[model samples]
Target: MKFLIDNWYLVLTAVISGGLLLWTSLRGKSAGVTTTEAVRLLNREKGVLIDVSEPEEFAQGHAVGARNVPLKLLSTGEPVKQLPTNKALPLVLMCKTGARAGRAAGMLRQQGYTQVVAVAGGLAAWREASLPVEKSAA
Candidate 1:
């Protein structure tokens, strides 16, 4: 007891740091779609891939049939013109990294999209997995 009381500040800091680490790990596990799962969805289950990057980024290269919907529009809750009307379909969101996809997924869920998912590593991971990408028409 004497040692703990002598180093109270150190003990408190360690406790707080442990709690923060635990929270972050839990959060990551709860979100994100793996590349293998994404491929299965696209190939067998008819999943719709939505790229949330800017037009220029999307035009560079994207999942073969991905529809572009800028993160700006999604974050603001503006109606995306290109989204399919069928909300029952599984919609996969992607960005440069996985971060924006997660946010977009949340916004889409709030907008009444019941079946929404964010790609774990976004377009980069898809490419790394040797998936096909389609370039925009010049």
Candidate 2:
């Protein structure tokens, strides 16, 4: 008790650091999909790739054969409802850096999609890997 009282600042810092470490581990477990894994899913699982980038960004360049759903449309639940494929098909969600894709994946799972995957690192990583991209007609 005396030692803790004398080193209260150190004790507080240690407690805060431990809490942050625990939070980080928990957060890391929820991360979905890496670029390599996503490619495997594409080739092996035939996952349907859905680009969540905005129209303008998507027009600049996007994965070849990827369908654009736009993050805004997904948030509003309109685009997903219009998706042609059945919900059971494996769906791969992708965006600029993957943050939007993660959100979209969670939204899809909540909507009863069983096999939704977020493409980690998203189009940036895809482009970095020299993968093919298609330019939209302006």
Best by TM-score: 1
lDDT of 1: 0.87
The lDDT leader among the candidates is: 1
lDDT of 2 by residue, 58-131 (tens): 89989998898987787775546445457887888888888898998888887778889887788888888888
lDDT digits (tens) for residues 55-121 of candidate 1: 9999988998889999898877777778877777788888888788899888888888888888898
How does each model score on lDDT? Answer: 0.87, 0.83
Which residue runs of candidate 2 sit more than 4 Å off their true CA positions?
1-26, 79-84
Which residue pairs collide, candidate 2? none
Tell me the TM-score of each prediction against the true structure.
Answer: 0.77, 0.76
Ten residues in sequence with the least summed lDDT for candidate 1: 75-84
Worst 10 residues of 2 by lDDT: 76-85
